[model samples]
Target: MTSSDRSPILPASAAAPRSDSEVERLHDLILSSLDDDQADEVVSIPLAGKSTIADYLVIATGRSTRHVASMANKLAQKIKSETGQLVRIEGLATADWVLIDAGDVIVHLFRAEVRSFYNLERMWGFGDNTDSTN
Candidate 1:
């Protein structure tokens, strides 16, 4: 879904959205690991006809430098322990933009300005619909 589609509002009166559990699972897990204050965007990029990276890319964010590193480390550990997958993390030294490469799904955690300046989603060809409320 696009960023303009509206943030997935969690109703104060509902049972919560269970519609996309797998996506949320990964999203929330990563957020928790990073202690995310809020998720700017969680999007799915369909390169169905163009590539072979499991059909999607999930973009997210963390609150700060420490948070980014903390989240990256936690996510790497989680991936290893839960899925037996070894995720390679990068840009930890900068912490302004940290990336977690999980093969089919790549996750991005960034400080707000850094996110805008680099704009990886757009550069990656998603353009304006790049999911991010920030």
Candidate 2:
């Protein structure tokens, strides 16, 4: 299914809408965590009106299964410790593709081949304006 059409594996947290700065802070935290972990090809897709699941969709790649798992684990811990927001993670067993649901930001971590196969960037119509990789 297309990323936009797929239902969140876990139900969204029932909380009041966050302010713009709050969401931006969370988004920035996620991106930085991934970057620090050496995530590659990171793309951030704004979902302000395109979807209700999250304010932003982050797609990234890791060199291998271990790398993907490590990134996902580190990201989850970082988000929780920094923002006190618990994130739900999936697909860590094989680590071919791991999904991190961080409230307003949804992260997808994949191995190089898996990332190319899913091509979430293309699925989400990512372009030059959407890339924020550092």
Candidate 3:
């Protein structure tokens, strides 16, 4: 099914109009944050009906490991300050690929080489049509 055809996997109550707007708000926040962080080849994949993990999957690349970690830290902090949600982060030590789980929006920050190797966008059916803001 197309990404837009998939229904969000949020709780029944969260399927209401209010929750939909919240999800959209979170998604927009994530995209803007990534852009502001200067992430390259940013791509957002709607996983609503396709995945139970989150409503949206955002993938982006950093110039290096430090950049990846910095982006993750900043994004996590932004999510917390904006939504009052404590985001879960992983792989910060290596900084090769950091994942931030912010309820409705999940973000993946990766080093250029690492991102190319994993190619989350292609795996998630985003193809090569990445929305690069670089």
Top lDDT model: 2
Instruction: Point out where model 3 deviates above 4 Å.
Output: 1-18, 126-134
- For candidate 1, what is the TM-score? 0.61
Residue-level lDDT of model 2, residues 1-134, one tens digit each, is 78999865543344457899989998899888888888888889898888788889999989999999999999888888987777888999999999988878889999999888988877775443676675
How accurate locally, in lDDT, is each candidate? Answer: 0.61, 0.85, 0.79
Cα RMSD to native, each candidate? 14.0, 7.4, 9.3
Candidate 3 lDDT (Cα, whole model)? Answer: 0.79
Q: Report lDDT (Cα) of residue 17, candidate 2.
A: 70
TM-score preference between candidates 1 and 3, better one: 3
Q: How well does each candidate superpose onto the true structure, as a TM-score? A: 0.61, 0.85, 0.79
Winner of 1 and 2 under TM-score? 2
- Residues 12-113, candidate 3, lDDT per residue (tens digit)? 223333388888998888889888988888878788777777787888999999889899998888877987666778899999999887777778898888
Candidate 3 residue pairs in clash (backbone atoms < 3 Å): none
lDDT of candidate 1 over 1-134, digit per residue (tens): 78999876432112232334554565556545544444555444544355644334556666678876776777788866765556777899988888777654567778778877876677665444544334
